[model samples]
Target chain A: MANPVWMVLRGVCRGLHLTGYFCAFGTALFGALFGQPPGLRRMGWGGFGVALLAGAAWFWLQTADFASASSPSAVLAALPLVAGYTRFGWLTLARMGVLLLAMLCAQKRCWKLAAVLSGIGVLGQAWLGHGAAMGGGKGWLLFGCSLAHIGAAAAWLGTLPALALGLRLSQNPRALAENYSRLGLVCVGAILATAFLQYLFLIGRVSAFFTTAYGAAALAKLLMFSVLLALAAHNRNRLTPALPASRAALGRAVAWEIGLGMAVLLAAGVLMQFAPPAMAMASMGS
Target chain B: MRRSLFAGAAMVMLAIAPAAFAHAYLTTSKPSAGTTVRLDTSSIRLSFTEAVQPEFCAVTVVDGMGTHAETGKPEAVPGHDDELTVPVHFQMAGKYIVTWHALSVDTHKTHGTYSFIVGN
Candidate 1:
């Protein structure tokens, strides 16, 4: 078993990396879908910087974990081996490259192109996950599900900050709210659908949900997601119709959604550290 | 539209099989865990649940006297991406321990140790 402290540290780094990537992706996507909002450029740049730094930290930590390296020199020696040889290493390097390209696009104010690159970076995450363990058609299907799951999640959660800014800046808050509400609905549907598929593939049994660390973290994430849904619903149903009059309330709700979304992302990061119950059972049985 | 999308996702989910395993884990060994083996056994072989990177994997065999019995580095078995083998030359082993650390092709790490008695 890995040390608890190191595991937590890795999870935190993973969460930060996801948060940063999602922020950049979301900002670009928002601009593409609903026109660029004021203050988004700074947010996008900040997100890119954070993602780059956190991604480097995540790679370093993963190298140490994989090699069981206790010293800096040992980790340094193992870095080349991991970065050059393993699938995870290759994907991480590729993702960093994509992120860099996305940053360049964002700098040039090519929102649509930036969004595409960042979205691909998000999709590439599927390869680093449990979906990559299996081979053949089933593996491909699982990867598809993972791609949808992450993309929907990034689209919805990542866009919240930009949406908040849009709400603040748009003279016609109602139009902006309606457009986002539609996108939010589609993202939510995709999230739920892919989440169900992932549960079947990863969890398999309800009992394992109670028995495993992965399950507990997943449950925590689900709870946070539920809160986010409620907030979205409140915004879409009650707040949007009364937009100008209820902008403050809607803003508070979006802020809450953002906080809860971050929590969910962090839980997801920690959850990936544990073997999914189905996988664990299969290993033990074999 | 949302309903159609959900229905489509449901159909896809029902069509797919659940994933069997993730991360490489030792499933079985040539000598087998906690079993008695003949001293003539020439190598230690480990079979994992998932394909592992052989170049990044390590396997060591040590006798009860704490002397290394393994002759060379672990190597992938021909046509078996999920298996690793290391040649061993046990001079006179009473009890031998085998420890292995594997990096799954997906880059997850796992390790374990097992012991077997080497008899006449």
Candidate 2:
């Protein structure tokens, strides 16, 4: 016989799930363009810190699952979930929404909005960063490690869109050339460091580069990344120097690279939906 | 000429999209919130509209002076119970309160609190 309490609990659980997904990711994505950061108020660090904590708590809860009804670990872990969720996720998000609105009312700068959005971008790493290779207790060190992972990613992946838009904004070679040089140098340090960490985290064994589903996803993204790099090389070497008239052809080439980078990002989105093997091992399949 | 306005309109639409999708909620709790009780209970029970992660979500029994009373652990019932159950030994309780927190699969975190007196 099922208890009425269980029935109600199940319903409420489902509601929390749906609402959390809808508000957190959906709202964050919308905020990206609308001028608010994903989970924090613009123009301050306080909103950003809480947003990070909220993301972590959300991650912790989403990952844990009680196995046996009478397990001690299950019961103990549950306390932190409750405490953190109430004090971290919901409360922070609520504050973020309020502050976000206030910032919208009070501010009038594009860079200000970009800074906020960049803060939201941090969770992308917390959700999907590196450090999966044969870890003992450092399995969940996201605060520093994950931050670096996303920083490099945003610098690399985020630049394509910015650079492409720059190219399109003008037919001037000087502007295109200057922006291209800056973007190129930034991508240099970013791509190398981030790719190294990504390899460390997800592709521990060299064989994993071809073995697991995650490995295959990584391979695909790498292939796409290579394509972006090739096109960038072409733009810098063959196109950035061309006159304003010939810039048309160069613009097309750079746009194609940006397009490829975006495709890689979409695949990344899909890859995140899969549970990491490390995660599975930690849970021990419950 | 009005590029900022266009950006604002786009944001407004995006922000509203997720708000339309609401989640389930807690229907009730027992021995009920804000009720005076004179009996020692075997377990704390919570009723939700959906199944929650028994591991990540839990209820704790706090004493009158804000000390935990559960000797062992709070566990969820097997075979799909709508109400999650927690075992509380209730050691020396003046005013015990049960606070619950949960994060669902969709990644939303929620919490609620209720208090009941051990001796009426």
Candidate 3:
């Protein structure tokens, strides 16, 4: 087992990295779809910077864990071997390059290109996850599921802040809200479909939900997700329709959604630290 | 509508083919765990369910007297990314413990220990 502190730190880093990537991707995507909103450029840039820094930290921490190195020097010494040889290391390096290119595109005011690059960066994360551990066709299935899961999540949760910002500035706030609501619905469908597939692939048995640490964290994430769904329903059914007149209330609701979404992402980060129940059972048998 | 989507997703999950296990786990070992081996055993070999990085992996074989019975670092078997071998020397046969810490290619770390008797 890894040191508890390191494990927690790694989880936190993963959360922050995901938060940053989603922010960049979502902001760029929103701009691509609905025109650039005020302050969105800065937000996207800040997100890219955060993703780069947090991703670097995560790679360093993972290297340390993999090599069982306690000291900075030891970790540095192992860096070449890890970064050069392992899949995780190579993927991390590739993601860094992707983020840098995305940032460059954003700097050039190419919102669509930036969005595509950032979305690819998000998809690239699937390989760094448990999905990459499997081989053959099942591996591809898990990979595909994970890509859809994270991409849809990035689209929905990542877009919240942009929607809030856009709602404030758009002359036709109702139209803007309605557009986002439609996108949210599609995103929700993708999220649900992929999430179920991933759960089946990773958890397998329902009993593991009660027995394993990963399962518990997954349950927590699900609860948060449910709350987010309810909030989205409230926004679409009540707040969005009454928008412009009830913009303040809608804004507060969106803010809550953003907070809960971040919490869900954090839970996901922690969940990745533990072996999924199916993997745990396999480990035990070994 | 949301409820319907959830139900539909559940149906799809159930309908899809079962997935294979992910993450690396010890699948088999030479001088298998908890078994008696003759003194002729030359090395300890371990195979995992997935590819693991040999550069960072560690394996040790120690006798009942707490003395290291394995020599040299664990090495990857040529042409096999999932198996590792460490040469061992047994002087006096008793019970020997084999412990391994493996770092899978995906960067997940796992470790385990097992004992085997080395009797005539």
The better candidate by lDDT, 1 or 3, is 1
Candidate 1 per-residue lDDT, tens place, A1-286, comes to 2787788778878888898889989998998899887788888888788888988888899889888888999989999988888877888888878977887897788989999998999888887776666665666777788889999999999999999999988899899999999999999999998898888878876777678888888888898899889889989999999979998888888989989998998898888887777774333212
Task: Please give the range of 10 consecutive residues that has the lowest summed lDDT in model 3 chain A.
Answer: A277-286
Model number with the top DockQ: 3
Q: Each prediction's Cα lDDT score?
A: 0.84, 0.48, 0.83
Clashing pairs in 1: none
- Candidate 3 per-residue lDDT over residues A1-286, each given as its tens digit: 2977778789878888898889888988998898787898888888888888888888889888887788999999989988888888888788878877886887778989988998998888887766666656777788788888999999998888888899888899899998888899999999988887788878877787898888998999999999999999999999888878999999899999989998998888878887777653343324
Per-model DockQ against the true two-chain complex:
0.38, 0.03, 0.42
Q: Model 2 over residues A27-60: C-alpha lDDT tens digits? A: 2322343333322322233333333454444334
Regions more than 4 Å wrong, model 2: A1-107, A110-113, A120-143, A277-286, B1-120
Clashes of 1: 0
Could you arrange the candidates by DockQ from highest to lowest?
3, 1, 2
